[model samples]
Target: MKLLVCIKQVPDLESRFKANAEGVWYNEADLAFRMNEYDEYAVEQSVQLREKLGEGTELTVLSIGPDRVVEAIKKALAMGCDTAVHVQDAAASGKDPWQIASIIAAYAKDKSFDIIFTGMQSQDRGSAQVGVTVAELLGFACTTTIVGFEYDNGTITAKRELEGGIKGIVRMKSPALVTCQLGLNIPRYPTLPNIMKAKKKEIIAIPVADLLREESLAATTSFHPPAKKGGGIVLEGDMADLVDKVIAILKDKTAVLR
Candidate 1:
């Protein structure tokens, strides 16, 4: 069995954020980067599948981003992926989901992978479109937000989480894609030996320009922080008086009450 897991490097959420000078995305200076949390589960699940399927199973992880993404790829390699492919783009932040998915699909179009795994969404963009778009571009059966997975006899069964605490099950044959959600599996920390081994693993670097088929379909025209909220007002009084005050404030401040 051949498996490919797509991962991404994202800004650590706790880092402070400010718009770049171009006003297209966040400034990267002094920011810490890490692998997207959801992609960790995808990588772990792929590694587990490879382990269960035996030594002959070849697992390759892929990521598209600037050179810094090598850090993320190395983590995946240490987690048991056999090799990695890095699609390097210095301006990766400028690309939209469609462009990103197109590059991935182009790379995998001829790889003949039996299964492709990806996180349900990225932490930075959170568009939640790239995985399914790749599946569509490759003409593979696809399921998203899967929290449980099983494979046997050349078929995959997935448990998908739905709205209102509902769960949906899906079964598909080989040559499929799955976007993993949280609670799918616990990600393992890379051991010291594995980290050393990962340093020697193969990482094929390809320029993003070679894989890109066309220009980005969408562009960000404006990017800014949300408006600051005003200070809160506290009202302490009897229930009837509080209700009257609330109504008066609403009538004075908002068109809805008026």
Candidate 2:
């Protein structure tokens, strides 16, 4: 099997964030970057599949970002990916989901990969559109939010999370894509020996401009922190008195009652 797993580098959620001066995105100046949490599950699941399939299987990890994303690529390598591709773009942060997906689809279009793995959503944008868009562009069977996975022969069985705590089971053949969700598997940390070996792994760099088909369909106009809210007012009285107090407050403060 020839497998490709897409990964991303994102700001650590614990980082202190501020809007950029242009008010279009977060200020990345002081942020710490790491492999996206969701992508970790994708990487782990891919690695597990590769191990199960053994020698004949080949796994490649891919990422798009500035030079700093090489760190994330290396991490995936250490986790047992055979090779990696880095789609380098200094302006990657400014690209919307469609543009990002287009680049990935363009690159993977001719790779003849048997399966593709991606996180359900990116942590920074949480758009959750790229994987499905890539599938659409490539005409691959796609599944999302997959928490359980199994492979047999050329077929795959997946358990997907659904609304109201339900699980949907799906089965598909090769030449498919799956967006991994949390609870799929526990991600293993790279050992010292694996880390050393990852340094020797191949990381092929491709300029983003070469693969991009067009400009983003959407653009960010403005980004701002949510407005601060006032403290709540507690009404302490009998039911009738509480009702009267609520009406009075609404009359005084809002247009609804007035």
Candidate 3:
């Protein structure tokens, strides 16, 4: 079995972020980057299959970003993917969701993979568009939010996650794409030995231009950080003052209550 998992490197939210001078995107120079959380599930799903399918299964991770993203790719390698492909392109930063999908589809179209795994959405941009878009572009069966499933006889039966704890099941043959959601499987950290082995594994770098030749379908015009959260109002007083504060707050919230 040959599996391809699309991975994304996103900013570690715990670190500070600052926008570039143009305000189009974050200045990634000092920010720490990690694999998208959901993509980790996708990677784990691909790796877990190796236990069942065994020797013949080959898992490959693919990512589209600048060179810095390779750190995240190496982590996936250590996690158990047989190899990786890095699509390096500075233009990727400004491209919109469809443009990004187009780039991936261009390379994936020729790859002849039986199954492709991807995160339901990226952490930096929660568009949730790339997986399905790539499927459509490549004419593959696509299902998102797969929480559980099984594969047999070159067919896949997946349970899709729906709102309110409900799951929708879908079945499809091989050469399909699946967007992994949380709870699919726990992602394992790469041990020290595996980390060392990953350094020797194959990592093929492809220029983004080779995948995307046309002008970007869309572009980023402006971006800004979300506003800081406000501190909650604290009530500190004796009984009389507390009562007055509650009444005043309720009255302020309700115009007629005044």
For model 2, residues 1-258, the per-residue Cα lDDT tens digits are: 899999999999988778888889899898899999999999999999999999989999999999999999999999999999999999888999999999999999999999999999999899999999999999999999999999899899999999998999999988899999988999999999999999999999999989998788898998887786868787796999999999999999999998
- Superposition TM-score, candidate 1 onto the true structure: 0.89
Error of 3 at 162 (Å): 0.8
Can you write out model 1's per-residue Cα lDDT over 1-258, one digit (the tens) per residue? 789999999999988789999998999999999999999999999999999999789999999999999999999999999999999999989999999999999999999999999999999889999999999999999999999999997899999999998999999998999999998999999999999999999999999989999788888987787886868798997999999999999999999998
* Model 2 worst lDDT window (10 residues): 225-234
Ranking by lDDT: 1, 2, 3
Candidate 2 TM-score to native = 0.89
- The lDDT values for all models are 0.95, 0.94, 0.89
Taking all chains together, each candidate's TM-score versus the true structure is: 0.89, 0.89, 0.86
lDDT-best of 2 and 3: 2
Name the 10 consecutive residues with the lowest summed lDDT in model 1. 221-230
Residues 152-189, model 3: lDDT tens digits: 87899999999999999999998999999989988999
1 or 2: which has the higher lDDT?
1
Q: Highest lDDT, which number?
A: 1
Instruction: Spell out the clash pairs found in candidate 3.
Output: none
lDDT of 2: 0.94
